[model samples]
Target: MACVYSMRSSLFWMMLVSLTGLAITGCATSVSTTTDKPRLAQQSVLSTLWMDRAGEYRALCHQAFNMAKLQVDRRLSYHRTLEKPLAVIVDIDETVLSNVPYFSQLIDKGEVFPRGWKVWMQMSTAQAIPGALEFLKYARFRGVEVFYISNRSINEGLTATINNLVKMDFPFADQRHLLLKSKSGNKQPRRDRVEQTHEVILLIGDNLNDFSLIFSDKPVVQRNNAVDMMSSEFGKRFIILPNPIYGDWEGALYDYQWGTSSAQKLKVRQQLYNQ
Candidate 1:
């Protein structure tokens, strides 16, 4: 397991460095009116987050899974029952498969999402996160059913996503267990489907939205309060992976309004800590 994970880690860097170089060149300029500095700044930060060998990016992923394993052990010793089948629900994209490469590819071309998104998904070359495969396999070994509940569109990226998971040797990569995004983008319905027969012990993902709909584009203060509200459940039943490069958390900064300029985003962050 150590040897294979190390190899995957190496492959991840190789792709990141290659794609970072490509993005630096591709996003040298954009069709949008946003200045070069903002695009250039985003590329720099994203590359550093994705490419750094010794960084918080790697450390946080490791921490999340370490805690998840502990959480699972505690759950079994203290809470689980034989009444229903046990399951661990996980989001697909950055939670299990590191889509930083796809994000890099998109930024490299200086293109936006909905344009290159499907292309990247079809390529389906995302590598598994460092501890995700082993931890999830551990869950299954403990008699837990692993159900993937991703917000990825149902008919669009489902097949490629499953293929990606299978290629990474993740267990339970099948249709019945793979629930995709419905038109609502709210996952509770699909989660409801799983709860009918399985007791979902852990909900794992990089984004809060992956665990519940309450996180959908709320105000920044409200979102923080919500996290505080469920603080107890975080490490126990909600395992959140780290994803600094992109997520709804960042979207909340700009009021969830699409097409907000990069300068505007910077301005908001600048004010986040002002007295």
Candidate 2:
């Protein structure tokens, strides 16, 4: 009886060791698999940092606005009289508002867009882009109509956007001058709508598409070529702000392929670095 009990005890100890070994192996495999998971959020870390912390970023924004003031002054001086009222068209995101906090949150949690975008919009805590408020106010003071043309969807972001702009003391934050995206992200139609009543002297944005449909949905080569072709208009009629974070430029890398997997996007970005 004593020998049998000892043998049973030894068998129990052997089974426990086998089960522990299997558990450790499973954990190792799980960890190994997670290493290949999507790292898209990490890619924007430097961009977010630059936008949030770099004085150069602020200087660039100030430079863009300063140039805008110069151009607007030039236009007003050259065309003292016109058939329509002088107007300036500008994009909302990245042009007039700094969304650094929202982007910083994404970097912290390794998340992507539309995940916290709506929440951020609703928060209405975004600050004015450097020199943006002052520039817009100057335009207003000079009797130039300020029109905001944004791709922010009407359904999800209209109210919050208006509220945020209004709260920030931006000129012309009302519905009449603030045009939100409806049924399309292409802003050409809205621009045309504004042009009907006002002579749009200047257009400002961070994305090339914000200026024209020519840059919309195009691949990298064509987009670059288009910029070169329209080089003369830049800083004159088309005032562009710097946005190194996310933009159509990044989308062009994927050939404008929307809804691509994070892993696939990361792979494309990596390959571009090698080139």
Among the numbered candidates, top lDDT falls to 2
Q: Which stretches of candidate 1 lie over 4 Å from their true place?
A: 1-52, 78-81, 259-275
Model 1, span 79-166: residue lDDT tens: 5465787788998877888876666655665544555678778787889887899999999898888999987888988888888889
Q: Please report the TM-score between candidate 2 and the true structure.
A: 0.86
lDDT of each: 0.79, 0.89
Separately for all candidates shown, the number of backbone clashes (residues 3 or more apart, or on different chains) is 1, 0
Residue pairs with clashing backbones, model 1: 23-108
Lowest-lDDT window of 10 residues in candidate 1? 29-38
Models 1 onward score TM values of 0.78, 0.86
The residue pairs in collision within model 2 are none
RMSD of each: 17.7, 6.8
